[model samples]
Target: MQILITGGTGLIGKQLCKALLAEGHELTVFSRNPASVPAKCGAGVHAIGALGEWHPGKTFDAVINLAGEPIVDARWTARRKQVLWDSRVTLTKELVRHIATAGRKPAVLISGSAVGYYGNRGDTAMYEAADAGEDFAAQLCKAWEDAAHAAEQVGVRVCLLRTGLILSNKGGLLGRMLPAFKLGLGARLGNGKQWMSWVHIDDYVAMVLKLLHDSFASGDQASLALASGPYNMTAPQPATNAEFTAALAKALHRPALFAAPAPLLRLAMGERAGLILEGQKVLPGKMTAAGYRFQYPNLDDALGNLFGR
Candidate 1:
C-alpha cells in the first residue's frame, strides 16, 4: 500500500509513517517544506507541498490528512480562531476539491477530525450517532468532515477520523504536561469530573491502516466510505479528568498538586480553557463495532504504556 500523509513531520504523522514503513507499505509525506521531513524516513517519502498547494498527478493507495494548526498553543483570539478554522476546514475543502477533480482518485482519504466535534458535553456520553455541538470546535469539525465527504462524488473513499486527545511522549497534550508532572505540580483542572477521551498513538496509527485496508475490500460504491462520517477515534473506556490526573501522577511517582481552578484557567486561557476544563465522555462505539480493537483501552494502562511506571 502507498500511503500519503499531510503533516508528516508532526508527532502522529511521524509515528504513523514509521509504522507503515515497517509493515512494508510505501509512503509520501505532504509538506510545505520538503526539507522539514527527517532524513531517517528513507526512500519512501515523496513531498507535494502543503494541502492547498498539492498538485494531483500521482494517485496514492491512501491519503491521510493531518494538516492543521494546534488549537491549544495560543489564546483563542479571533485571529487564532480564524487560523484554526482555515487550517482544518478550509484546507480540507481545497484538498477534497483537488481529489474530486483528479484524473486518478485515490482508493481512500483518511482525513483527521477530532472528538472536539462533541463540544463540552459535561458528563454526557457521546457516540458518533450523537448530534454535534454548535461551538467553535464542534463547528470546525463539522465543516471539516463535510468538506472531506465531497470526495465521494469522485469515486473516492473517504474516512473521517474524529481523533481524540493523542497520548504520546512525542507531542500533543502529554508533551506539555510532562514537565509539570515531573516537578509534582500536576493535578486535575477544576472539579476534575469532566470526561476525557484519549487514544494511544500506536493504536491511532493502527486504526488508520485498518481503515485504509477496509476501503480496499469495499468496492462498487464510493459513497460507502463516507457511510460513517464521524467515527469516534478513542478508546472503548472513557476516563474523567481526575482519573487521568491521578493515574499520570502515580505513573510518574510524583505527588499530585493542587487543582487548577476553572476560573483561573478561564482567566488564563480565555475560551480555550474549555478544552481542558470541560470534556465530553466520548466512546469509540463506531470504531469498535466496525471491527477495530483498542491496544490500550483503560487510562491506567495507557498512562503506564506511555509514561511507564
Candidate 2:
C-alpha cells in the first residue's frame, strides 16, 4: 500500500514511516518541504510539497493525518491556544477539503485525535463511541474529528484515532521524565493519582497499519460503522500518575518520588498545569474489542523496555 502521511516528521510519524518501510509498503509524504523528510523515511519514500496539492487522480491506499502542534510544551495563553487549535482543527479542515476536491478518494483517512476528547473523566470509562468532553482540548478534538468525518460525506472511509499518551524513549512524556528520574530528582505531580492511558510505540504503529490495511485496501463495502468513525489506540490497562512514576524510577534503578504538592504544578504550568495534574483514565476498550494486541500491556513492562529495568 502506498500511504501518504501528513506529519511524516513528527515522533509518531517517523516511527510509523519506518514500520511501513520495514513491512515493504510504499510511502509518500505530504509535507511542506521534501528535504525535511527524516533520513530513515528514505529515497523510496517520495514526498509532495503540500497536502493542498493532493488529487484524487493520485489516490493512495491510506492517508494518515498526524499533523498538530505540541500541546504540553508551551503556556496556554489566548494566542498559544489559537495556535494549538489551528494546528489540529484548522489543518484537518484543510485536509478534508483537499480530499473532497481530489477526484480519487484515498481508501481510508486515519485522522489524528486524542484521548483528551474525553476530558478529565475522573472515574468513568471512555469509549470511542462516547461524546467528546466540554473543555478547550475537548472542543478542539471535537472540531477536528468533525472535519475528518466530512470526508465521509464525500464517500471516503475515515478513521479518527483518539490516541493516548504515546510512551517512547525517543520523545513524548517519557522522554522528558527519564532524565529527571535518572538524576534521582524524580517526584510525583499533584496527588499523582490521575489516570493516564498509554500505548507502546510498537503497538501504536501496528494499529495504524492494521486499520489502514483492513478496511481500505480490500475495497470492502463501506458502511457508517466504526470502519469510518473513531477508535482508541491505547493500552488495555491505564496506570495512575503515581504508578507511572514508580515504574519509571524502577526502570532507571532510582528511588521513586514522594508526593508533589498539587499547587506547585498549577503555579508552574499555569492554567495548563492540569495537563499533567489531571488526565483521563481512558481504557483501550475499543482497541481490544477490535482485536488489537499490545506488546506491552502493563506500565511496568513498557518502562522496562525503555530503560532496561
For each candidate in turn, give its C-alpha RMSD to the true structure in angstroms.
2.2, 1.9
lDDT of 2 by residue, 114-146 (tens): 999888888677887778888888888889899
Task: List ranges where model 2 is wrong by over 4 Å.
Answer: 38-40, 217-226
C-alpha TM-scores of all predictions: 0.93, 0.94
lDDT per model, in order? 0.82, 0.82
Best by TM-score: 2
User: Residue 99 deviation, candidate 2, in Å?
Assistant: 0.7
The TM-score, computed over Cα atoms with residue i paired to residue i, of candidate 1 is 0.93
The regions of model 1 sitting more than 4 angstroms off are: 40-43, 51-56, 218-228
Candidate 1 lDDT over residue span 40-134, tens digit each: 35564766665545456766777788888998899989999999988888888887777776667787888988999889998788988888788
